[model samples]
Target: MIPLSGDIGNAKGIIRENLGTVETRRGTTTLKRGFAHMLKNGVVMDVTTVEQAQIAEDAGAVAVMVLDKLPADVRKAGGVARTASIRIIEEIMDSTTIPVMAKCRIGHVYEAQVLDATGVDMIDESEVLTPADEFHHIWKWDFTTPFVNGARNLGEALRRIEEGAAMIRTKGEPGTGNVAEAVIHIKNVNTELRRIKSVYDAGDEQDLISLARELKVSYGLVEETASLGRLPVVNFAAGGISTPADAAYLMTLGCDGIFVGSGIFKSDDAKERAQAVVLATTFWEDPLKVKEAQKMVDERQSMLGLDTKNLELRMQERGSTA
Candidate 1:
C-alpha cells in the first residue's frame, strides 16, 4: 500500500535538507536508507558473474547481490567465505543499470570497508559468510555505505537497527530451499510487534521499558516501533525463497520485498525462474497473476530443496547473541 516511488523521493528530499551535502555521514546514511526504500515491492537476486547479472536485470530484478558463491555452494564449500572478488563486483556494476550489493562477513569491518571503497550500492553484513568475529558485528554506523542485516526476531532486528542498519531481512535459513523458516521468522516479528502495540495502546509505559530491556534496544526505539506497529525501516524477506509462490507468500505476509539467493541460478531454468519470481513479487496480491507466474517455471526445475531441520549449518543463528 505504500507508494514506493513517492515515499523514496520524499525521503531523499528530507536527506538533502537535513545534511546539505550527500558526502557527510548523516547525508550518506539518509541517502543509503532512501535508496533502499526505492527497491520496495521488488526482488533482489544473487548473481556471481556479469552474465548472470545481466540475466537478472533482464528478468526485472530491481537490484542484484554480487557473491562469489551462491548460498548452496557456500554451505557445500565449508570454509572462510569472504566477500566476492572486487573484479566480479565491479563487472556486475558495469553491466547492470540497477543497484549492485555485496556481502561482507559478520563483524568483518575491513571487508565492509573494502566493499564500501568499491562503491557498492549497498553492503550486507551477512551471516551466510563464516563469521569473522564471534562476538561482535561490524559497527555499521561507522561506515558511509548503508548496511542491511538479518534478524530472526524483533530483538535482533532492533539491535541491528540501533547499529545503524538501513534495512532488515528475516534471517530465514539460507542455502535451504525451504520457505518454512522464513515464514516462522516473519510471523515471530509480526507477533512480537502486535504484543508491543497492545502494551503501548494500554498506556503501560513500564511494560514498554521492560520490553526495551528484554530486547536490549533503546526505549525511544521501542516506543517508536510500538507506535508504528512495525520496523521503522524497510523489512524484506530473504534466505530460503525458491519459487514464485514462496515470493508471493512473504509479500502477502507484509514484507516490503524479497531476496532470492541460490534460488534462480541453482534451478534448472535460471532465466525463467528469475522472471517468474519478479512477476510474483510485483503482483503478489493477485492470485491469478501469482498462478501465471508459477506457471512460468517448471516445478521439476526448482532447486533441490533441503530440509531446514536436516541442515548442518544454520546461517540465521549467527547473530543471535548480538
Candidate 2:
C-alpha cells in the first residue's frame, strides 16, 4: 500500500484499523500509481492483431496496442478516433497479462473513458490517427486513467504533459513507412533543451515549460514538474521506427521507450524484427549482444497493412465496427 517506506508501518496499521486495508491501498498504489509498474521499463508493442500482440508479449514488450486499423486507418478513415472495437481490445487484453493500450479519436473523451472502464492500462490520444472533432486534446485529468498522446512537435508534447498524460510519444502516421520524422523530433527536443538551459539555471521549484521553451527541449516533464525523477512519466519514441539501428538511435537520443507498428510487422521478417527492436532498445550499449540479437530479428518483417485489412473485413461482416 504506501510503497512500504520508513516507520509508516505503524502509521499504516493505525490507518488500516480505522479506515480499512482496502481503503489504504486504494489511496496509495491503486489510485496514486495506477499502471505505473505496467510501464516502468517502457517497452510498448503496437500491434493490429492478437497474434502480433502475443508475439510482442513473448518477445518482451511491456505493453501492446491493438486496434482495427493502424496508419492506414488514419489515412482512410479521415480521423482515427475510436477506430478499434471493444471486442478487438478485449481479445488482446484477454490474451496478455501485460498492459494493453489503444488509440482513440481526438477530443473523443467518451471513447477513451470507455476503454478505461474496460480495464485498459493506457490510451494514445493519437493525432496521427485520430479523427477528432477538433484538436486531439482530451481532458485526461477528468478520467480515471493514464493516457499517452502523440505530438509532432515539442509544444504539443508539453501541452499533453501538462494535461496529465502519463506518457508522451512521437506521432507515427499510422501507415507511413518513413521513420525520419520521429527521429528528427527526438533529436531536436533533446538538442534544443540544452540551448534553453544555457540561458538560465532553472530554479528547483520553477515551471518546466518556461524552462523547456527557454531550454528548447521536450522531456516527459518540464523540469519543475515532477522532480525530474527517472522522467515524470514515460516518453516513448514512436512513428517511423524502422530497424534495430533506429531503436538504438532513439535510446541514445534519450527515449524512455519505443513503439513499433508497421516497422516490425511490415518487415519481411516479423518475429525477428520484433525481437531485434526489443533487444536494441533494452540492451543498446552492448554491441556484442546487439549483434547476436540482430540475428534474432527477421530482416524481412511483415507490414501492418495485411493485418489491418483483415480487421476491416471482419468489421464489415459484423456491421458493428468501431
Candidate 3:
C-alpha cells in the first residue's frame, strides 16, 4: 500500500523542491525531455477530482492528468472544451505524490501559459479539447514547462517535436473505449520509421532530403530520427485504452508508456481497472503477469466502446497540419 495522505503530502513537498530546480533549468531541451524520460514504462491516468487523483496515485500510476471532465463526458457534451479549472488542478497537485499533468486545447498558447504558471509538472497540448486554433500549435520552446503533444504519424510527430514538444503520444480517437484507432496509429508511425531508417541505411542523403520536404520537417531532424531509428524523444500510446489487455498490447508495440483517459474513472470498477492497467503496462512482456492483471477486472464493468467509423467528432483530426 502507498503512504497515508499526510506522509504523501510531505513527500510531495520534497519532490516539489527538486522540481523547482528542474523548472529553473527549463528551455534546456535535455532537462525538459529528461523529465518525461523519468516516467517511461509507467501509466499516466486522467482524473477530474482530488478523489480520482488519489485513487490513481494509490494504484501506482506514475502521474495523474487533471481534467475538467473525463473524455467521454466532454465528447458527449459538445461545447467549447477548454482547460480544467485551476483550483481543481492545484488541489490534485497538492493531494497526489505523483506528477500532475493537465491538458490545454490544441494551439491555445494562453491556456498553456496559464497551466505552466499554475506549476503543473507537464502540459498536454491536446486534441481532446476543442481546437483553439485551426492552423497552429503552441511554440513549446518558449515555455519552461515540458509539453506533450499527440500525433498520428511520423510527420506529425516530427512537426510537434520541431515546435518543442518534449514528448509525443498517438492521437488515437479519445473518449471511445475501442483501441483500434490507437493500434492503427502506432503501426502507421512504425511503418514510417522503418521507411526512413531504410533510406538512411542506403546512404541516400538526397532521398532523405526529399523525404524531409515531403514530411515538412527540418532535414536535420529527419536525419537524426533516421539514425536513431525511432522518435528522438519518448513516445506513449493514448486514447481509448480501456482494458489491461489494451494497455499490454500497446506496450508490445514499443510505446514508452500508457495514458488512460475514460478507461479508469468512467468504468464501473474504476479502482480495480486502474490497478490492473498499471500492472499490465509494467509487466507487458510477461504473459502470466498480464493474465493475472486481466483477471482483476470484469469485461462487463468496462465502458461501452464507441465505433471509430461512426464518430461525429474525430478529435485526432482537429489540429493536425500533416
Candidate 4:
C-alpha cells in the first residue's frame, strides 16, 4: 500500500513519541491500513447492543460498528448523536470475536481519544452524528486506533486519506435507504481517478500539481494515487443500502466492501437480512447468488426509506469542502 503519510512507527512508539506516554495500543498508518485490508470483500454492520453484535458476528460480518442509534433512528430523534456509551461498547467488544468498530463525531478529537482508550478495533469519524467541528476533521495521525471517514467525491476521499484515514466510505445519504447518493459519490471518485491517471500517463507534472491543489491534498499523495489508479487505502460503500441487490451493485462498482447501518436491524427479519447481505457481498459478481439472496427478504419488511431530497440533514455534505 502507498503510505499517504511517511512511515509511522509502531503503536507504542507512536504514543510514547507523540503523546508522552506508553500505551499498549499503538496506532500506525501501516497497521491501521492492514486492519482495513483484512475487511476487504466483506460487510461491516452497525449494532447498538451486545445481542446485535453477536447477531452480526453469527451472520458472518467481518466487523461490527457499535453505535447508540441506527442511522434512521438518529434521524428521527433529531438531536446530538455522539459516540455510543462505553458500557455498551465494552459489552459488544466482550461478546464478539470479530473486530469491533465505534463511531466518534467528526472532528471530536477527545471523543476519539476516549474510544481509543476503550480499545475499539477501529473508530469511524462519522457524519451520521452531527459534526463537532465543521471547518476541520480530526488529525487522525495522533491516535492509535485506525479511523474510517466518509467522502462524497474524490477530493474529500483523498483529503481524508492524506489526513490519516485508514479507510474511506462514500458518504451516501444515511438512513434514507437510498443508494443513488452512494452511486454518485463512488462514480465521482472513480471518474476523478481515471482523469488523474490519464494526466499522469501524459507526464504532465504541472497539471498533476494543479490537480492536487484542486483535490486539496498533497501533490505526492495525488501522484501516488494516480500511479496506482485507485485510493491507497480500502474504500467501502455505505449509506442507504437496504437490500441484497444494493450490496452486490456496490461490489460490482469496485468498492472493497459495504457498510450496512440501519438496513439490517431495522428490517423485520434482521437475521435473514443480515445473512443475505453478507452472502450478496461475498458473491457479488454472481447474478444467480445475488438473486437468491434478494429472495431471502421481503421488501415490505425493510425500513421505511426517506427520500434523499427530503432529508433535513444531509450528513453526506459534511467534509465535502475539504
Most accurate candidate by TM-score: 4
Model 4 C-alpha lDDT per residue in residues 137-252, reported as the tens digit of each score: 98887787888999998889888886778999998999888899999999999999999999999999999999999888888888888988998899999999999999999998
TM-score of each: 0.92, 0.75, 0.92, 0.94
| Error in Å for residue 37 of model 3 | 0.6
**181-246, model 2: which lDDT tens digit per residue?**
677667665554454444335443345456565533443345433332223445678776767776
Question: Cα deviation in Å at residue 102, candidate 4?
Answer: 0.4
Report the Cα lDDT for residue 115, model 4. Answer: 94
Per-residue accuracy of model 3 over 193-261 as CA lDDT, tens digit each: 999999999999999999999898889889988988988888999999999999999999999999999
How close to the true structure is residue 265 of candidate 4, measured as C-alpha lDDT? 91
The best candidate by lDDT is: 4
Each candidate: what lDDT? 0.88, 0.61, 0.89, 0.90
At residue 198, candidate 1 shows an lDDT of: 99
**lDDT by residue (tens digit), candidate 1, 234-313:** 99999899999999999999999999999999999999999999999999999999999999999999999898997778
Lowest summed lDDT across 10 adjacent residues in model 1 is found at 4-13
Better of 1 and 4 by TM-score: 4
Residue 8's lDDT within candidate 3 is 13
Q: Model 2, residue 4: displacement in angstroms?
A: 19
